[model samples]
Structure formats: C-alpha cells, structure tokens
Target: MPTALVTGAAGFIGYHVCEQLISNGYDVVGLDAMTDYYEVSLKEARHARLESEKFTFIKGYVEERDLLMGLFETHKFDLVIHLAAQAGVRYSIDNPRSYLESNIGGTFELLEAARAYPPRHMLLASTSSAYGANTVMPYVENVRADHQMSFYAATKKATEAMAHSYAHLYDLPITMFRFFTVYGPWGRPDMALFKFTKAILEGGSIDVYNNGDMSRDFTYIGDLVSALIRLIDVLPERGSAPAGETDSLSPVAPFRVLNIGNSSPTLLMDFISAIELATERKATCNMMPMQAGDVPATWADATLLTQLVGEIPHTKVPEGVAKFVNWYRDYYKC
Candidate 1:
C-alpha cells in the first residue's frame, strides 16, 4: 500500500480525506493539533471515527519542526497533504500572531522537511480569502492576488510564494489549492453552516452577516474531496503547461495553484433558507453588518480544476445543507 501523510487529519476536510484515502487502500498517517479554536471534542470525535489498523493518528502541531522532521525521517511518504493551518478570517484580526505561527511558520517547517525527505507530490491548503479584495466574479488561478483583506489570507498567500521557491530550488512537485467556503457533514463550528444549524435547532437567532447580502461559492466536502483525490495524480511538471490555458504553473518551478470551488455563488439568505428547509425551523435573524476582514462575496472560476480533474463540484446548496442538518441532528441527538 502507498503511504500518505495528511496534516490536520482531525479537521473537517482532513478527516474526510483520510477516510477516503483509507477506503481506497492507502496506509495513512494522520496528524492534528486538536486545538480549541472551536471545540476540541468535535475534532476528537471526527478522529475517533477513523480509528483503524490502516490509519495511524498523531496529535501535535505541524509548526513543531522536531515532530515533523521525526515523522519524515521514519516514513517515506509518497504524498504529503498539508491541510493544517490557522483558519478563520475574523479570528486572524484579533490574533495575527497565531496565523503567522501556524500558517507561515508551520508551512516553512513542512517545506524544509519535504526538502530533506522529498515526497512525490505535496498539496497545500489555501483559502479563497487569499483572493481578498478582488472584485472578480469567479476567481481564476492566473490572476494576481496580492491585495489580501485579512491577515489570514496574507499568510496563506505567503505560503504559496514560499512553496514556489522551494519547488524551484529542490524540484519538489507542489500544488496549492485555494478552497472557497467548504461545508458539509463534520464541518467546523466557526463556519456559517455549523453555527446556523445549531442555532436553528435550539430555537436561537442566527447572525446573518452583511445583512444577508453576502454571497459564497460553498463547495461541498464530498465534492472537494473528489477534486483533491484527482489532483494527487495530476502532478505539476516544469515548463510543461499547455499553451492558451490560464495555468498558474510557475515558469521556473514545478508548482501551481488551483481554485477548488462550486463555481456558483449563492446568496447568504438563500443559504439560511436552505438551513431552514433542512431543519424545518424558522430562524430568528440578527442582521449584522459585514464583519471586519470579510468580503461581501466569493466565487471560483474552477476552469483549471475542471481541465485537470475532468469534473467539477455540482452539489446544490439545499441538497448539501440538508445532509449537514441530518448529520448534526443524528450526531447530537437534537
């Protein structure tokens, strides 16, 4: 069996990735910090569900160079998926240091280890927030995204640059994918779907940011996982990009960035209505202004993703929301 190392293995997306990898007959090593950003128990519960002989779990921060180097020395990882990072746009404003430590510092550590013990392909997680302040309807990979609205996005962008330099110098095949508002079962509590579900179930009010005027290209977790698995095989080759393609392939390095999203921006209110339909409960709305370090909208171009993966995410908002609601009710016995 091929060996793969997945960071943030306890996170919402990471857990699903590990599950899919194990099911496909891969020996997976999973690492998670189990941080209390939202609820550590929720992450623990997700990890617990994946316990098996094929899945090895390690609890530690990826920023720890010693821990990461030790793991690299022991296991010859064929593929390295770096999903662990400090996530959240709003939280980054209050705690910029955390983002620096986890997003920038941690990624540097991973790159160094990968240099010493190279993996076949290294995939890193980036956010659509990195497209900060861009008015582009559907964000394409080739566009310049230097104007980041949040510290979170800035750090993620930095990692993209950092990864590219390593790829150029060491010939490490690296692919960085920017995710656009990922949601589904086992989602994070800080996200809109999870918070709205809990509030609606408890008959509490949900905070509708930007007075429900915001929009997002909410990619379903299952669809995102499928895209990721496909990308693992589509490694970047130096100077091999086809002509006339909007490829973000680095001219001097085997590195590229892809945007993985639904490509359909749904209104915030419609997303809330999906929750209401799923839960059969009317939400008391607290229409609030857009929070600091938040964009009013986000949509992905996803042309490159389709060109590479041969498929696109097509999960409709209502259908995906219904699945999350069902999982929440069953998991919490609500």
Candidate 2:
C-alpha cells in the first residue's frame, strides 16, 4: 500500500482526509499536536473513529524537525499532506506567535524533511483568507494574492512562498491548496456554523458579524476531501499546464496552487436561515461590526481545478447545512 504522512491528522479536515486515505487502501501515518485550540475531546473523537490497522497515529508538534526527519527516514512517505497550522483568523490577532510557530515554523520543518526524502507530492493547506485585500470576485488561482488581512492568513501565505522556494531549490513537488470555508460534520467549534448552531440550539443569541452582510463559498468537507484525492496524482510539471488555460503552475519549479471551493457564495443571512431550517428554530441574531482579520465575502474560481479534475462538488447551502446539523444533533445529543 502507498504510504502517506498526514500532519494535523486529528484536525477537522485532517481527520476526514486520513479516513478517506485509509479507505483508499493507503497505509496512513497521522501526526497531530492535539493543541487545545478548540475542544480536545472533538479532536480525540475524530481520531478515535480513524482507528485502523492501516493507520498509525502520532501525537506531536509539526514544528519538531527531529521528529519529522525521523518519520521521513523511516517510512519514505509517498505523499505528505500538511494541514497542521494554527488556524483561526481572529485567534491570530491575539496569538500571533502560535501562528508563526505552527504555520510558519512547522511548514519550514516539513519542507526541510521533504528535501531529504522527497515525496511524490506535498499538499499544503492554504486559506481563502490568504486572498486578502483583493476584492476580486470568484478568486482565480492565477490572480496575484498579497496584502493579507489576517496574521493567520499571512502565515499561510508565508508558507506558500517558503514551499515555493523549497520546490525550486530541491525540486520538491508541491501543491498549495487555497481552501475556501470548509465546513461539515466534525467541523471546528471555532467556525461560524458550529458556533451559530450551538447558540441557536441552546436558545441563545448568535453573533452575526458585519450585521450578517458577509458571504462565503462554504465548501463541504466531503467535497473538499474528494477534490484533494483527485488532485493527488495531478502532478505539476514546470511547463505542463493544460493548453490555453490560466494555470498557477510555477515556471521554474514543480509547484502549483489550486482553489478548492464550492464556487457558489452564499450570503450570511441565507446561511443562518439554512441553519434555522435545519434546527427548526429561529436564530436570535446579535448584529455586530466586522471583527479584525475578517473579510466580507469570499468566492473561488474553480475553472483550473475543473480542467484538471472533472466536476467539482456543488452542495447547496441548505443541503450542506442540514447535513451538519444532523451530525451535530447526533453527536451532541442535543
């Protein structure tokens, strides 16, 4: 079986990706720090569901170069999925050091390890927040992204540049995934969906930032995992971008960037309505001004992704929200 090393294996996306990888017959080794960014119990529960003979779990920090180097020397991973990052946009405002340590230092350590034992492909997670300050609609991969609004996003962007340099110098095959707002079952409690659902179900008011004026291209976890799996073999060659297409493939390095999103932005109020419908309750919304390190909206242009991997998922907001609510009710027994 092909061996894959998945960092952040206990995280929301990491857990789903590991489960999918194991189901696909890959011998997966999952490494996670299990940081108390949110609820540790949720992370542990996700990892618990991933127990399998084909899966090996490691609880540790991604920034530990010695630990990562040891794993690289031992397993010779075919794929390295780096998703272990300090991940909250607002949280980064007060905890900038954590972002630097996890998102920046952790990625540097991973790249250093990969230089020694190169994987077939290294998929590192980026965020739509990295598309900072750009008011362009339908974020295209070829569009120049700079002026990040959040420290968390800035760290992720930093990793993108760091990985690119490593790719150029070491010829390391890497694909940076600019993920839109990913949400579904086993989602992070810090996310809006989870917070809002919890508050609404508890008969409490939900904080509606920017007076609920924002929108997001909320991609479901299942869809995002599927997109990732499909792109695992879509290796980037220096000059092998599809003909007559706007590709983010680097001209000098075997590296590329792709946006994995639903491509359909839903209004904040509409998302709230979806949750209300799912929970069969009206939300008492507390309107508030936009917080630091937040954007009013985000939409992704998945044309390049479609050209590479056939059809992308288009799960509507109401449908996806319902699924999450169902899982939340079942998991929380609320």
Candidate 3:
C-alpha cells in the first residue's frame, strides 16, 4: 500500500481527506497538534473515528522540525498533504504569534523535511482569504493577490510562495489549493454554518457580519475532499502548462495554485435562510458591520480546477446546509 503523510489530520478537512485516502487503500500517517483552536475534544473525536491499522494518528505540532524530519525519514511517504495551519482571521489579529508559529513556521519545517525525502506530490491547503483585497469576482488562480486583509490570509499566501520556492529548488511537485468558505458535516464551530445552526436552534440571534451583505462560495467538505483527491494525481510539471489565462503554473517550478470552490457565490442571508430551512426555524439576525480582516465577499473561478480535476464543488447551499444541520442535530443532540 502507498504511504501518505497528512498533517492536520484531525482538522475538519484533514479528517475527511484522511478517511477518503484510507478508503482508497492507502496507509495514512496522520499528525495533528490537537490544539484548543476550536475544541480539542472535537479534534480527538475526528481522530477517534479514523483509528485503524491503516491509519496511525500522532499528536504533535508540525513546526517541530525534529518530529517532521523523523517522520519524513521513516515514512518516505508517497504523498504529503499539508493542512495543519492556524485558521481563523479574527483570531490572527489577537494572536499573530500563533499564526507565525503554525502557518509560517510549520510550513517551513514541512518543506525542509520534504527536501530531505521528497514525495511524488505534496498538496497543501490554502484559503480563499488569500485573495484578500482583490475586488474581482470569480477569483482565478492566476490573479495577482498582493493585499491581504488579515494576518491569517497573509500567512497562507506566504506558504504558497514558500512551497513554490521549495518546489523550484528541490523539484518538489506541489499543488497549493485555496479553499473558499468550506462547510459541511463535522465542520469547525468558528465557521458561520456551525455557529448559525447552534444559535438559531438555541433561539439566539446569529451575528450577521457586513449587515448580511457579504457572500461566499461555500464549498462542502465532501466535494472539497473529492476534488482534492483528484488533484493528487494531476502532478504539477515544469513547462507543461498549456498557454491559458487561467493556468497558475509557475514558469520556473513544478508548482501551481488552484482554487477549490463552488463557482456560485451565495449571499450571507441566503446561507442563513438555508440553515433556517434545515432547522425548521427562523434565525434572528443581529446586524453587524464587517469585522476587521474580513471581506465583503469571496467568489472562486474554478476553471483551472475543472480543467485539472474534471470536477468542482457543486453542492447547493440549501442541500449542503441541510446535511450539516442533520449532522449538527445528531452530534450536538439539539
């Protein structure tokens, strides 16, 4: 069986990816810090579900160079998926140190380790927030995204550059996929869907950021996982990019960035309505201005993703929200 090293395997996306890899007959070594970023128990629970002979879970920080080097030397993994990073935009403002440590420092350690024992392909998770202040709708991967609205996004963008340099110097085939507002079953509590469901179900008002005028290309977890797995085979090759405007392939390296998202952007209030429909209850919205490090909207241009993977996140808001609500009700007993 092929061996894969999945960092942040306890996270929402990490857990699903690891589960899918195992189902596909891969022996996965999962590593996570299990920090209290959201809830450690939830992370533990996700890891618990993956316990098996094929999946080995290790609890540790990815920034620890010793741990990563030891694992890379031992496993010599066929594939490496980097998903462990300090998430959340608002949290980055209060605690920039954690972002530096996890997002920036962690990526550095991973790249160094990969340099020693290179994998066939290394897929790293980025965010749509990396688009930052770009007002252009349907963000294409080739777009120049320089102005980041948050420290969280800036660090993610830095990782893209970091990975590219490593890929260029060491011939590390890397795909940095940026995710737009990913949500689904077993989602993080800090996200809108989870928080909105919990509040609306408990008869509390949900905070409507940007006065509910914002929008997002909310990609479901299942769809995201499917598309991501597909990319593992679409290895980036130097000088193989077709001359297209949507191609984000680097001219100097076997590296590229792809936006993984539902191309359809849904309004924030519409998303809340989906939640209300799922819960069979109306949500009281507490209108709030846009928070620091937040954008009014995010939309993805997944042409490159489709061209490479032949699939995109197509789950509608209502359908995805209903799936999440069912999971929430079952998980939380609400």
- Please, what is the TM-score per model? 0.98, 0.99, 0.99
Give the per-residue lDDT of model 2 (tens digit) for 245-316: 678899899999899999999999999999999999999999999999899999999988888889967888
Candidate 3 CA-lDDT value: 0.93
Comparing 2 with 3 on lDDT, the higher-scoring candidate is: 2
Q: Write the per-residue lDDT of candidate 3 for residues 1-334, one digit (tens) a residue.
A: 9999999999999999999999999999999989998988898889999999999988899998689999999999999999999999999999999999999999999999999999999999899999999998889899899999999999999999999999999999999999999999989999989999999999998889888899989998899999988888999899785536779999999999988898999999888888988999999999998899999999998888888867655998899999999999998888
lDDT of each: 0.93, 0.93, 0.93
Which 10 residues in a row give candidate 3 its minimum summed lDDT?
237-246
**RMSD (CA, Å), each prediction:** 0.9, 0.8, 0.9
- Cα displacement (angstroms), candidate 1, residue 156, comes to 0.4
Tens-digit lDDT track for model 1 on 1-334?
A: 8999999999999999999999999999999999999888999899999999999999999998688888998998999999999999999989999999999999999999999999999999998999999997789888889899999999999999999999999999999999999999999999999999999999899988889999999999999999999899999999895423788988999999999999999999999989999999999999999899899999998888888878755899999999999999999999
TM for candidate 1 is 0.98
> lDDT of candidate 2?
0.93
